[model samples]
Target chain A: MMLNLAPNIADPDDFYAELVNSQRNLDEEQALRMNARLILLLANHIGDRTVLTEAIARARAAG
Target chain B: MTNHIYPKFGYLRSKEQADGVVKRHPIVVIGAGPIGLTAALDFAARGQPVVVLDDNDTVSIGSRAVCYAKRPLEIWDRLDCASPMVDRGVSWKVGKVFFHDQLSYQFDLLPESDHQWPAMINLQQYHLEEILVAKCRANPLIDLRWKHRLISLKQPADHATLAVETPDGIFTMEAEWVIACDGANSDTRKMVGAEFTGQFFQDRFLIADVAMKADFPTERWFWFDPPFHPGQSVLLHRQADNIWRIDFQLGWEADPDAERQPERVIPRIRAMLGEDAQFSLEWVSIYQFACRRIDNFRQGRVLFAGDAAHQVSPFGARGANTGVQDIDNLAWKLAMVLRGEAPEALLDSYHEERAYAADDNILNSTRATDFITPKTKVSRYFRDAVLELAQHHGFARPLVNSGRLSVPTPYATSALNTPDEDFAIGEMRPGTNAADAPISVAGKPSWFLHCLGDGFTVVTFGKATDKTGIAIGPLAAKIIRVGRDIEDPSGLLAARYGASPGTTYLFRPDQYVAARWSGFDETKIIEAMLRATGQDSARHPAGQKELAA
Candidate 1:
């Protein structure tokens, strides 16, 4: 299966703003913990191995 | 009074010249460091004559390269030097990482108990060199010349001629092959006009060895921005002979000379220890990090190993461990070529395999250095964020890279590997280093690695097999039937190797998996043997395409 290259999330600005807002007012440590938790939760939600592999490849390529 | 004494090795006279001409040797190693001595001893064990030339007669001065990983220890075990090292060195696998006087996380590298050696040992490099040098001296085939320096080298197609300068006079000697392990500032590399290219991190670290009697547990203790030294990282390791190695991260602008002074260094030590804690300074040096390697490890008849071929920061303990591995990979190939079992083209695989390992080391080291000493404000911000999160969250703990400890690099995509076939059970795939597990030989406890001699070995899980049809050219091959001749009491051999009854494996001299099959197939085994020795082109196993799909 190919990666979902198309825009999946609607209102990209709203999502970006929400991400920044979640980290807002939190200390450096708290912000880091929040991001880590978010990553873990999303990863658990998307537990498909093939999709994870594709996403990892895309991220590495972009990096 | 400190009991650490630098052992002085007696120099041996150069072999007498025949009719006013220097005699040629089969192999010449240019340095007496751990890497050079390891190569010489390995070659000697393989029944190849070797000559080792060094400018100094003494072991390494400081406690340099203090960490010995498991793979190198296993290689040393094959050479019969691992026992002394494990006996003398401080063996530990648990590491505790702290942030600002609070324990952030702790890790156990090897939690399983089936392996013969621990994850790593903390021993001074001099002690290891002393052991290796003694072994080389005991071997009749190894000629070690101390105080002999290489002045120039000329490779004339068939052989390489090296001009050496001794205390008495200069002389010239010829060799079928030359291995340059002369260290970072290698003269042989200069003589060959090879370029070592890489970036140097703009950071300095102070290494202090102190002799103290303390009750601290024998474990690696690392601190990032402790109360004693704010905004810096500190690494503490307990070595043999009541000596403790402490490394403090000094910023790029710190004065190396000032930091090395006893007056300046004592305060830092006192801060870590209480004011009344007693300790004597042993050795101090300042170092900078550089991740660089030569483009090619082999240049015609002369090959480079150890620090001469590549250099990485000491963060991951990759410097000496990887260097020892270089010798491990090259020794068998060189011995095979010298014995005419394989063609000269086989030597190219050395360059291919070790250069890949060097790149792997450099990549890990670079990432660790970048994480530890972040280059920009944004990077530092994220680094501190991750560090802070690591204190509480388990998921963030893996993101913390104080230093990823060194592990053996698998040559998964190597040209010599016959890729994995139908059997896929464990991580022990083709092109991977062999995993050591506890087993029983004739009802006696033994290690599976010990059963693999210094030649291509065919290991079958059960029942002895006569495969006279399999031909590996002029190279020797041994067949080991585990269940029939040997017993796996713990069943670790089968578990770790992913073997079952009638399972078969082809292992190279360096204990790397060359191929595997569910049952003995003479034609496929012969093809794998030829490819592993670089006699035939690398062909992907028929099952590989299916597995990839």
Candidate 2:
């Protein structure tokens, strides 16, 4: 029913490294496209629209 | 296992030539493929006489349209052919997708269901045609003629005339109504001057049916850049009779004829299945992906169904499945019109609803084709990124679109549906296909669909009373009371259908929910039935304030 925004990844640093390494050889445009795709994939994974809207507002506020 | 031998239905001479007079028929269906034959059988079962015309005398040549989806299977079940097809075909739902030899994700199409049919079945089109042809031959109302091709068509003011070319000579015939179930290259379509316009993907695929003894499970296996075939996608499915359908994506420029040769194809199969795998090539064909449909399916007295009306890529198994649904939608309406029970305007809804379905199928097919064969570098990048992320991330799994396996498109915004007023209770809403639930009929377990016969059906959760009257124009609707007449011991009829004690649901002839209410009101039920049959154009009398209690 509600969103769980807690840290759930087993090894956060290892996942961050893996995600960065996956985009190692991509150019600027490709990297941007990959980021957009990642955002979409994650958004779809967090299927609840309410949580997605909250996450979007929080990220925008931080920026 | 023995190879399927195509049965030949001997050619019958037209009675028009023997009698030297043209006799008009109620319905004349062109093309004896799966669509045409199914329409003829459906018409005959509804007490309408039909004459089927086909150019060929035998069934389909290769295993064309091998995947039969559930919606079409449900329609076929009403015509008394789904059980035989299911008994012979391989029923499957689990599909495994791999990215560069690494398994990415797996999906179950129908995770939970007590429906009468499976989500998908891998059966050869010819096997289905054989069953339909046999059924048509047994029916006294269906006059099937082989080697009788429609060379020309003329639709005058009242009726349509067709020029047929037979083995002996050409003959002319007249019909009250004409249905074109012809294949993609339709002579009827050309004669009517209707254009099929859409996009054609710049990719070719080689489909080879190989007969082999293997232990592969009956599931769809798809691979992107496997070790055996690099830089292209491959699909493998296990059909009946130990035949395996293997498709390898060939680039647009690949020579179709050269690639079909055994010297060229055997090596590819040998690479995929170890070099020593014993197999004999059964059938091989090359095809380009294209998603196209006509502007309209109905033109005056002549109607188009199946591939003649629309076509989609084979990715989602939508071509034949949608065609069968077209028949299920059009048959009852056409019958009612021919009997003068409903107005001819009912035929227009067939065009409105099926054209909507065609657009939906084409959209899904185009998206699948683009995902499989990305046109631009950016597209490929996103596709690859999705695949890469799907391997580890749960969120990315939904982005993998090998093919969005075909499901019945709900007619959510059709003119026939009576909008829900209070709340949407169940998944079976108006304009949606009635979901099948288990129940007991006379103390024996049966399906709810079995109780809802071919005509317009009204089902009530409790006992039927004087208030539960349902009439569609001149046709008297069949009413079924679940708790009183039919026993529902499992309570699934109430649970799945979202029914209360006095809830009533009106279903169209095709078993689509036309309207539902908390309690049966005869006036409201009759109005809904008339609106569903395109009779009362009074625009769904505004509010439901009168039924608050």
Candidate 3:
């Protein structure tokens, strides 16, 4: 399966703000783990190994 | 409750007090703890006179600050004290982390070989102090004054005078420079009005040093929510003399007094060490730690090092290791400034570099504290998730925070570092501490770090040559030709330093890389030394062609 290249979420700016606000008042470690949990939850929802592997590769390449 | 007996040195009246005259010394170190005594030893190594004052005449009561890292051992080696420590201390490299009786992850601190010292060692603070005190007593350049307490400090325009109360009487003494190594509750810090600020943890940990004859392996074992103590963290480490140091986390609501009693502490130890294990209680104490540092490490003619300047949680074994590095970065600069080889502004870089390292330590300690004692339910859930994954996955292993074992902090953004003229490889950047390797000096077996003198060193990786005219401003740079003067038998030194035939490296007095170039350039080397000594203010922008020109 091919990982989607185009933006998929509606109102991307609002979603980004909400994603950041989810970690409000959290310490650095707490916020990092929260992000880790968020990634795991989203990966479960996607539920595609090939897509997840491609996404991971893309993330690594971007960094 | 401690089984070990404390050694005491009776107070003696100083000749200055007997003469009823105030004497001014070159350096005055307050508090004869490990840091203060080490400072005195460092000054003596440079052939400078130092007077060390302590309120008491004995080593500290409890077995505090047990773990000593490799960097500090190297520093002690320079002062001719590492041999006794390594001989007496228990050294280990591997640490295992468990989550509720299940192994979560394990780590090897020093996977690479060919180093002089081990990754880390565990020896009680009192034992370390006893070793250092003996060294100080042997050195003629050091004066150890026992039972002398500082009453007040007055800093004038020219110098600072300390009024100390001894067994004889209160007397005044002066110093060109004063160092405060008076531990966490520093009276010198309060007297000098140095503002200390940071996070205050609302948790308590019970530290018990137990003497036992068990056959436990000499490795660090940490547990989170184990069966012995549910919903809490426990750390186990081995020290010298058949003693084991155990730290049990008791939440903020636990009573400090009740937790210290043997009746309450024995059951906790029995649950972890098994009920039939015969162990005698050596020492038991309750402590609450904070991750805080002073506003500045230097205040005019007076400076602070060790716990007097910064405080951190004991989780990472950072408390004394970081402090020893502070003194390592400080003493040479102070010597140069005192001898008028460098400008007084050179002292400012001590604050710049050490304060940066202090912040790094505090950040690590704070992160570890937060993970081990999560404040929020969501955070604890994430921590548990990471632990659960760590048992089966490799990626999650990095997320486990069983106190990021103390490592030397690189001054990446220090002003003293000259931008590299050559592309850098490996970890040997401008402000990074020098790494050691196996080498032969003139056909005899020796370590690479043993070749560094107490002055600036210029290492060129080619044949021997007459580099006599090479001098960095007023300071002469000792030239060491690796191929001719020192042979890299296994080529590990050259490989670790990323050196070619003509590669040239300049190291500071403290053995930190100041700058490196692909080829030897006299002008560039001098400029780098000037910049490292805070003599040059011009910034050498990275990747600039002007250096080539």
TM-score of chain A of each: 0.76, 0.85, 0.90
Question: DockQ of each candidate's interface versus the true one?
Answer: 0.17, 0.34, 0.13
Looking at candidate 3 chain B, the ten consecutive residues that score lowest on lDDT are B540-549
Cα lDDT for residue B458, candidate 1: 88
Q: Which residue pairs collide, candidate 2?
A: none
**Which residue pairs clash within candidate 1?**
none
In candidate 2, what are the lDDT values of residues B1-549, reduced to their tens digit? Answer: 226677877877877966768778889999999999989988987899999999999998778899999888888888888999999999999999999989888999988777789999998878888888888988999999999989999998989998889888888899989999998888899999998989888889999889999998889999987889988999999998898999999989999989988899999999999979999988889998678988789988889999999989888889999899999999999998998777799899999999998999999988888889989877777888888888988878988999888898888888889888647467788989888878887788888888888888888877547433455437567778877667778777788888787788889989999989888777778778778888764553432222221
On the 0 to 100 scale, the lDDT of residue B107 in model 1 is: 91
Q: Please give the distance, in angstroms, between residue B193's alpha carbon in candidate 1 and its true position after superposition.
A: 0.9
Ranking by DockQ: 2, 1, 3
Candidate 3 at residue B126, lDDT?
A: 93
List of clashing residue pairs for candidate 3: B2-B282
* Model 1 lDDT tens row, B1-549: 235788877666665532447778889999999999999989998999999999999999889899999999999999999999999999999998898877888899899987899899999988899999899989999988999999999999799998888777788899999999999999999999999999899999999889999988999999888999988899999999999999999999999999999999999999999999999988888999799999799988899999999999988899999999999999999999998777788899999999999999999999989988889865666676667767887756776778889998898789898877775757888888999988887778888999888988988877647542244447556778777666888888898888887788899999999999888876677778878888663354542233223
